[model samples]
Target: MKVLLLICVLALTACTKESEELRMRVQQSIPVPATMSQVLNRGILYPTAGIQVTGVVRVVQLSSGKQLQIDSFSITPGPDLKVYLSQNALPGNHLNLGNLISNNGHQAYNIPANTNLSAYNYVLIHCQQFNHLFSYGKLQ
Candidate 1:
């Protein structure tokens, strides 16, 4: 039993290390676009995965208007993930941006043209199928 448990622990550690290495490689490869010039707000996403989630959430003013950008973003991948602009830390009273496109790297979600930007203060990465919050960054 002790030997088996030790083996499992070692295997899990190896897997975690490999995942971290892969995440770093992907993040390093994403180039920030020059068109992302008008930064309206910024926040640092915090992990709710019980593992490290690192990224910057930016509200940028594009020619089309305001949109949210997740830059150099990474988090543990899970199923049925979605993004939200919320008034609270939890998922309720939220504006569902749509399904998350990737578990790591840069992505953007559009804010409705009529949205009152000041009303929502959090950018949430949530697991809709499980109703779980994966992480969040407070909009500033």
Candidate 2:
């Protein structure tokens, strides 16, 4: 009876450890900002398998009327993942905003606004498919 109980305890301990490791795998990809009030004052919903993500890239306008360029890039789901932006809609000089691949959802490239809008008027969100598994972002 003593030996049987010891075996059972060992089995339970091993299962617990495995469970913990699995939980850590599906973690939030994005970092939560300290001052979410300013950016996410409207509140944002982040899709979670078992992780938390907060914040998105925003275009901030400086006092000057010169569009500042911001760029960010991330690897896609597959090697061949590609992104295309609206040439006509985006600011003329501010091309090459960044690339969003199929695997990862939208990543932000913050550009300082040069117009009176004080924010980005037009944003082109690109993904391989509309209903992709990793489609996530803050609700405007």
lDDT of each: 0.84, 0.34
Q: Which tens-of-lDDT digit does each residue in 1-140 have in candidate 2?
A: 99999999998888434566565753343222222223321223233253333333343333332222212322224333222222323233223334442333444333324333324333333333442322133223
lDDT of 1: 0.84
Prediction 2 TM-score vs. true: 0.25
**What are the C-alpha RMSDs, in order, of all predicted structures?**
7.9, 14.1
- Best candidate, lDDT: 1
Q: Provide the global lDDT of candidate 2 against the true structure.
A: 0.34
Off by over 4 Å in 2: 1-45, 48-52, 63-96, 100-126, 129-133, 138-140
- What are the models' TM-scores? 0.73, 0.25
Off by over 4 Å in 1: 1-34
| Model 2 pairs in collision | 60-113
